[model samples]
Target: MSLRADLRVLWRSPGFRRLTWTRLLSQGGDGMFQVGIATAFFFDPTTATSPEQIAVGFAVLLAPFTLVGPFVGPLIDRWQRQRILLVGNLVRLVLAAGIITLVLADAPVWSLYATALLTLSVNRFLLAAMTAGLPQVVPAHQLLAANAVLPTLGTIAASVGGAIGGIATFVVPSVSDNSLAVTALICAGLAFGASSIAATRISRKELGPTHPLEKLDVGAQLRALTAELLEGERYLRARRTPWHALGVMSAQRLLYGLVFVASILASRSILADPDDAEAALGAFSIVLGFAAVGFGLAAVITPMLGDRVSRERWILICLGIGAVGQIVLATAPTAWALLTAAIIVSFAVQGGKIAVDTIVQRDTEDHVRGRAFTLYDMAYNVAFMSSAVVGGLILPDSGWSRPIMLGIAVVYVLVAIVFARTPHEVRPVPPRPVAN
Candidate 1:
């Protein structure tokens, strides 16, 4: 079927529609929340804008999840996913309010970070639940199209939300940075509340674990967590296609993270004056805007080609596109060049991601799917975190390094070649039935 027809079919399903809305709203709130934090933390005039400082900020946000993410999967597998969706957003709603209050009161930076960290940690659960529950909403045959469309839409929603937050920062005349951040946080809290309401529209059992877990004592379940996680790892390793797809996705994320850090630094120092935090934020927002356009294009293009080609082949094509984008930036190192590269690389990364998500969702069993996705998230964050560290060490504060950009391009090309050579034949696992 064509991408349009696939979407039409998906839209006909009530479950798919509700789940999509839930994802869109949740991710939109995430975007707004992140913008508020960025304005307060990274783009603040008082903050030290350095590669090392940026790396540390990323570590502080992501490292906790990396350590705790594995334990989340088993609970997702055991609990009612619908409840997770509802309760998670509700929790974030409260956290968003806390953040707003902190901004208003001039709370300690550590206190603000603590609250934001809690908000994001809950966010991790919400995302994993959505991914794990997706196969339940649509037929297995449409997984690719669903994956292609849903996530891309969510990303676009996030971009829109971020833009709104950015606008909020500048709406008032002579607005203090704290006031601007507070305005954005208020908006974010509203989004989170709306997302929670959307979650309530889906039926309690609509997104499922299929088989209910045998009841276990709290102590027993905690003890079994390690064993279950190990079992999940074993299952994923046994499924070679998903395993290899994940490895490719991780490589793409790592490269993307490196570029991401460079873009931030460049936007702050090279593209705009370092001392003018507002101008730096504006520059960075423009880069993200271009990247959002790329994400939308990938949403359209990936589905169109999905029916015509194997996902593995499409991933290779994406990596090649990424290499081309990086080469452009490496050669030019200008504002227009950076924006152009942002578009191309964003398309490549998001395209590859859609394919990988479909592969992992389609190949893994439903019971173990939650664990599969959590593992996927872990790898995803770890790769990005590692890249931030590497970028910190290698990139100059100006974020213009021909050698590093070229090196990234080379890595993309090599990964494409190596991944294409590897045997990753399309192997469709039979779809499991959803419990009514």
Candidate 2:
């Protein structure tokens, strides 16, 4: 393709712009949800410290993603992805309202947890739809560049939401209940607006030959669902690729889980500003956001470098950078030092998204993209889930010390080793440029 054609095909495309705007809204809301919930759980007067209660509340939100994997993946493949995205975002309006009202009413904590989980589940599913939709929107040639830019935008939105949410928790009155409610409502409103804008701009014509769904037996469908739920693991067990990638991603997330638990403990123990826990939490994110700024810069550069580097090369480089950064995070002596390390870690870690995602997009087929990407999503989530469950058992007794950090570091190194040894069969091959 000529340079002019490439530019018009990607940059001038209406579908591309719509995808960008909607992603910003969705991820911004994600940052709002996390901050809102943390406020309710950590700072809200009505929250209790019962260990079981904390587990249950957090699990309830995460559970829907785990359980819904089977149905959601098949649905993304079987439906018009944009339609699903529009409907899903619009519906969150009600889900957000419900949680906000319950928080205000001081409803049973279980109700609040359940509502948050449902809203988040819906959010997770729509996110999957969007991921699966991208390749369909852009020509295969532009996949790498599109993947890099969209995710960078989402990171930016998340940082904005987190910072704003943190500040909102402090500034808003009647915030004991209404603060999160207001945040949720804004998120939902933006979601609806985003979906509508996308509807106007994106032509349904480019979506490729629509594969209509066929009916299946109830028992057979159940069996298929069970298989799909375990499909990612099965894929790994049967193949050489995904499991290695999974190991890398899982170890990284396990470290992240430890980081979260450790940061919480470190704020109280090491920093001794137990009362300023909020700032410590904010500090962690602020530093990470600054790092995301670096990722955003890379996003801009990746397109220019697109012809120069293979996507797989970028993945290997990013993973190495991330693993080393995690080591710095584990050993950093002070909160400010950790924050500085965080800036570095964030840049290294985020580059993984575009690289990893491009690999999946190029490697997986359109027919199976939904299942493939959803399973990847599940792998990433289940990694965190497993880490949380296992770490929860270990961290409380261990007191957020080196035991957790070093262990996670070792896991990351192992992941790096395995991925390094992984063969090229499944790795993405960069597209060849056309001579003018």
Best by TM-score: 1
Off by over 4 Å in 2: 1-9, 42-58, 104-106, 162-180, 183-187, 205-209, 214-224, 227-247, 297-306, 394-400, 427-436
lDDT of 2 by residue, 1-436 (tens): 3333444557677777777777787777777667766645532324423333334444655668977776667667666777676677767766777776776787997897777787788878877888888887787879877777777778778767766765665666653545646665555556545654665455553442257354535565555655554554454434445445555555666566555544544444455444554554455445455566657656765566667777656656666676665677667556665565555555555566666777677766565567766777777777666655665566652234555566666666666676777774664333222211
- Once fitted onto the true fold, the runs of candidate 1 whose alpha carbons sit more than 4 angstroms away are 1-5, 103-106, 168-178, 214-216, 425-436
Clashes of 2: 0
Candidate 1: residue 227 lDDT (0-100): 78
TM-score of each: 0.92, 0.80
Task: Assess candidate 1 and give its lDDT.
Answer: 0.86
lDDT per model, in order? 0.86, 0.62
In candidate 1, what are the lDDT values of residues 1-436, reduced to their tens digit? Answer: 5557778989999999999998888898888888866765567767647888888878887887787788766778888898889988999999989887887888898898889898888888888999999999899878889998888878888888887887877885545767877877788888888988999999988899887565746786777777777777777777778888999999999999999999989998878989999899899989988998888788888888876888899999999999999998998768999999999999999999999999999888888888888888899999999988998999999888999999999999999988888768645444333231
lDDT of residue 153 for candidate 2: 70
> Clashing pairs in model 1?
none
* Overall local distance difference test of candidate 2: 0.62
TM-score of 1: 0.92
RMSD (Cα, Å) of model 1: 3.4
